[model samples]
Target: MPVTLAIAGLLFATGSNSARTDVDGGRQEELSGLVSQENRKVDAYDQQVERMQREVDRASRARARNDKVAARAQERSDELGRTVGLGPATGTGVRVTLDDAPRTEIGEGNIPPDYLVVHQQDVQAVVNAMWAGGATAVQVMDQRLISTSAVRCVGNTLLLNGRVYSPPFAVTAVGPTDRIAGSLEREPGIRVYKQYVKTYGLGYEVERLTEVTVPGYRGTLDLQFAESGR
Candidate 1:
């Protein structure tokens, strides 16, 4: 999935070389249109999911009312659901924003173009630091974090949960704000990133929020595994 997403990013970021003389060939604009269209589709699907989930919840509650076993199972499912980020998380925490450095003339000081862009590891560092700081929940862009969630990138754009987002990505977490702030400060990857922020002017900012809510994970939880040959 990650590999496929990376390829999609490449397609969006760089159009066919044989089809055009210029590097981008005005594909950035086309990509923007496609992104907007996909976002609308996602929104529609979310609405459909919400309606179906409400129906399921109502039916579960009805069954639990008359069946002792069903009641116990529903109670257990609710408990586990909260622990696994199936429900919304709300509390005080931090919102960290990362953006690419402004384009500059490639001349003296010999700075690589890569240094000016935010990479996959850069976002992962922040998420991991938040988790290490005891974050109850973390969100990248608008998607809630699950154990299976993967952060990926191609060029300066971010790929999260099958959606592509541009620079100025925001990572929000609900937890102990002070501890998370300290962890962000102490993280080695973040420290190196900060140094680049100082030298190359990359956009890195952390804002401690008094209150924030990370929505429940609405994506599928089914996992696929390979079966061994006998």
Candidate 2:
């Protein structure tokens, strides 16, 4: 009689466990369904926003086309475009490439923590040096530099204009080769970077191009601002 009671207890426990599992699984499915429904709604809303923006842009552009003042404004736009490196430029110049140091055993010295990675100053140093060296037009990666071009770094990657680029950033400029090279050598920031290159295996390369072409700016040049101090 004792053995029979023990077997009956085991069967009852097993049945209870199975029922609990089923209940938990049903709840999980219901939660998943709710999440999926929300995601679908969000997707639909995003599509609606995109369609509205497209319609707005089309309307604005059409108005510009019908206005004589807009046509005259485009003439000045063409001139400003070339001056800001928005128009493609081709010439002989020097190209500078700066890359982060290789991941290896750091050499013995009082090296700062900053030597391990390439910072914005490092990139800016090269760009500024090139401009000072008399670079007619400059480009970071494949994008052309405009009057509004700004070089910025976030973490180890570079943020130029509106795009992000990984290590081994390339800076190309079109102008006198001799002056560009000399400017780079004179830049104090670059000299310090060079010291780390020997210690930490940082990459630095300069190439001279007899003929190279940099594309014009492809982003919006429109400025939107209002007078302050109302």
Residue 96, model 2, lDDT: 89
How big is the positional error of residue 121 in model 1, measured in Å on the Cα after superposition?
Answer: 0.1
> For every model shown, what is its TM-score relative to the native structure?
0.85, 0.63
**What is the Å distance of residue 109 in model 2 from its true position?**
13
Q: What is the lDDT of residue 12 in candidate 1?
A: 53
Q: Kindly list the per-residue Cα lDDT of model 1 for residues 1-230, writing each as its tens digit.
A: 44344446555554334235556657766666766666566567667878898899999999999999999999999999999999999999999999888766223347886787788899999999999998999999999998877787866677666666788999999999999999999999999999889988899999999999999998757653345799
> Model 2: clashing residue pairs?
86-216
Off by over 4 Å in 2: 1-74, 106-113, 222-230
What local lDDT does model 2 show for residue 213? 87
Worst 10 residues of 1 by lDDT: 10-19
Residue 42 in candidate 2, Cα distance off native in Å: 20
Which residues of candidate 1, in runs, are more than 4 Å off?
Answer: 1-24, 104-110, 224-230
Question: Top model by lDDT, which number?
Answer: 1
